[model samples]
Target: DLNQHIDNEKCTKIRKQIRLKRTKIKKYKKQINDYSQRKHKYEVQKSILKDRNSYSKTDHDATFMRMKEDHMKNGQLKPGYNLQIATNSQFVLFYNVYQNPTDTRTMIPFLNTIQETYGHLPEYIVADAGYGSEANYMAIIDNFNRTPLITYGMFIKDKTKKYKSDIFNTQNW
Candidate 1:
């Protein structure tokens, strides 16, 4: 009877440990799989964000930008693409989508896309002040035989009375 009591109480401690380990493995099996899935998702996101400052989580190609349509008053930036579209007399001419927020950097690429897609550029490349820059102007002058009627960023300020009165102002000349 004493030998039977020993076998029941303390003779198989290793077997007890084995049973506990098996229970733990069964309980945490789903947790280990969840952790593995999360790690894979993180790796995918890192690859998608390579060589970019920021990319939208929902739309990997879109960048964070301030949209005019934000319903909130906080002026919060959201995922968006800069669309450069040209129109004349209410007719669409050319359009391009850019990840950059500023229009200045999109001008040359937009022009190139226009030429590539249409096989010809308009005589006058007209754009707003935002698309105006010395680099853009030089590209238009050197690469294409087109005229850039784009105004610079200071177009409004240059037209002011204070600007016109300045002797150093080139517009005064």
Candidate 2:
């Protein structure tokens, strides 16, 4: 009777060991699945970063830019290209697509394109305040041999200020 009792105790211990092994297997399988998912996500991100101007999954060449039209009132980024054009008398003389989102950086490349196509630069470049920068101003003067009539970012604000005293007015002359 004592031998039979010992045999039963050993059988119960073996069953508990098997149950613990099964639970461990399930936990390991779940961890492996999670690791695979994380690895796949990293691979996709790496592929997107391989392209310089890519901001969208559908269009790899498009860049994220802030548009003037914001219906939501929040500045949302949209994937698009900068379209630069040189016009004369309301007619489009030359047009170029730039990958850059800012007008400040697009000036030199657009001027270079115009020179490459027409073999000469325009006499004057009249652009908005968005294209105004020290580098852009020098590029127009040095490379294109033209003057940029571009307004600085604070041109309008500076003109509207009424000084309390004429001592601050440099334009009084």
Candidate 3:
């Protein structure tokens, strides 16, 4: 929904430019393929020639590259950008978006960041399987004295039978 804040006209223009760039890159890809079966000298010359067609080639590549670079710079849309929302006793917003990816390796660092930002730790932490490594669990207990509410590996998905049998006993948590 970040695009919600962007100007409509600007977004349209950017999309149009991206589509045009993609078409150009596609054309270059075919040209490169045609050159591939030729001698190395021919391939090099074709690549050099392709580079000159800025709008048709380099511009297209640059557009995608810039989009990725901008996301990385902002730390809001990286592959590892994890969104963490915290709630207090009444379930009201406490603190959120201590930006990071769900990596057990980063758990302590991010927990530290949250503490620095909010001046304290939540009584417990909850995260999906991505953040369920031993390192993160230990850090939560040792550093924060908190039990991380992680999904137990024993749970199985079964929606059909209500008031279920022994297969769906205590392991369903």
Candidate 4:
């Protein structure tokens, strides 16, 4: 009877140890799950903060622009400022740095910068098709009183005969 009593005590002790081990395992699993959830939440928050127009952390004023780097053949977008330069006779007449990546909106601002510095606008302005917006043309004519010798965006396409379906061909002439 004493041996049986001792056996029952040992069985109860083993069961208690098993229950304790299971409780510890459950606690550890809950902690791991909580950590995983917190990590995921932080990752989501980080992604949410990153927007299309997000600036560089190193240079806050510099915006993301596609640059022609030697290492990157695909032209990766990096943080940099757009430089606008006006030249005459192979000499740089005026230069400015703009935050905007596109040249279409930078023409007027660059011209205005030149005017502000020189106190007079040029008689004529010449630029590529990229600076051929109507607003820029109007600004050159009305605000600066200068002739804009800029081409339209589709100037090359319009010049090609293959693109012109309705225009009469001069091959017969």
Candidate 5:
């Protein structure tokens, strides 16, 4: 296994760092709750201003002040980097991390990195529905020079009704 051949001491250190990150996320949650309490009070003040369409007043002043304070305090939240991996039949050789929140933007960047490292494009690519989009599909054709067989999860909005089929959705396409 990979663990048996890796440096045990370095693995131990990485595990310790992960524990610290978990604690940091817990603290961020607590701070967000405190801000929510203050924002509730501001909502009461805002209600008074709505009754009178007249010019500015102390209630309006208080609302703006409270909103600004809450925005500043709640700015920090639990966040993490995204991990991207590229694997082949033989092995998983490439992985990268970024702050991107969705797989849509990641497809091209990941392919580019793999090409740079391996000196050739992969013949096939497979990913979940989250990574399936028009842009991502085009990237596979234009950038990777390969046709990706993408799989998307089929979901029906109305469970009671059968999905209507059209020419575009048929297997013939």
Candidate 6:
């Protein structure tokens, strides 16, 4: 047989080469599996963080926002919720936890939630300049049929002496 004719040294050399190739193949398979697992983990994290700028790894639902007290004082964003609370007299009327950090986009939704949940609407709603905008005023007047006592963005600036004394000011005209 041809197998019987092969030299022992040549046969052993061939077996060693085959073993080396097998080890390389196994390593490649393991690397491919590792890559696949990493890709799957990234996809899952992305799904959890939909539409958010950043999310806390410790708390998946928590979004990163600037806190009122920044211990670091470097404007470092920490994971937290934007809490909107409405109070009448001394008691709490309605409160909401929002994912977005800005208060600008929250006023309308806060009013809508109160109306839907409690089946009531107040005649006059008071809010700060941060919640003031033309769109918010229109929604309050038209959609909610309520009066908004919200200060416009330039309300404070308009009260300045320079602005009040200027004859060329639009309000003066």
Best by TM-score: 6
lDDT of 4 by residue, 1-173 (tens): 44444456657877676667667878999999999999998676566435335566677677788876738587788988889999888899889998888899789889888989999876879899989999999999998888999998988977776766645655423
Residue-wise lDDT of candidate 6 within 33-123, one digit each (tens)? 9999999999999999998888999998889988879877899888998889998897898899988877888888888899999998889
Best-performing candidate as measured by lDDT: 6
Query: Candidate 5 lDDT (Cα, whole model)?
Result: 0.63
Question: What lDDT does each candidate get?
Answer: 0.85, 0.83, 0.57, 0.80, 0.63, 0.86
> Against the hidden reference, what TM-scores do the models get?
0.65, 0.67, 0.36, 0.62, 0.45, 0.72
* lDDT for each residue of candidate 2 in 113-155, tens digit (9 for 90 to 100): 8899999987889999999999999999987889889999978
Candidate 3 stretches with Cα past 4 Å from truth are 1-80, 88-103, 152-173
Total backbone collisions, model 6: 0
lDDT for 22 in candidate 2 is 64
lDDT of 5 by residue, 38-151 (tens): 898768656755643222343232222112235568654323345797766758778997445466777788888888887987577887776878888888998678988776
User: What residue pairs clash in candidate 1, if any at all?
Assistant: none
Task: Give the higher-lDDT candidate: 2 or 6.
Answer: 6
True lDDT of residue 10, candidate 1: 53
Off by over 4 Å in 1: 1-46, 70-73, 164-173
List RMSD in Å for every model shown. 7.3, 7.2, 21.0, 9.2, 27.9, 5.7
Spell out the clash pairs found in candidate 2. Answer: none
lDDT of 3 by residue, 1-173 (tens): 22332334366777676667767878999899878757786665567445332222323222111123574476443222334545556675544442232345455776787788778876768766656777778878888888798753332333335525545477444
Those runs of model 4 whose alpha carbons end farther than 4 Å from true positions after fitting are 1-52, 70-75, 166-173
Point out the worst 10-residue segment of candidate 1 by lDDT.
2-11
Candidate 1, 90: how far from true, in Å? 1.8
Model 4 steric clash total: 0
Q: By summed lDDT, which 10 consecutive residues of candidate 5 come out lowest?
A: 59-68
Shift of residue 10 alpha carbon in model 1, Å = 19
Q: Candidate 2, after superposition: displacement of residue 99 in Å? A: 1.8
Assess the local accuracy of residue 100 in candidate 4 as a C-alpha lDDT between 0 and 100.
81
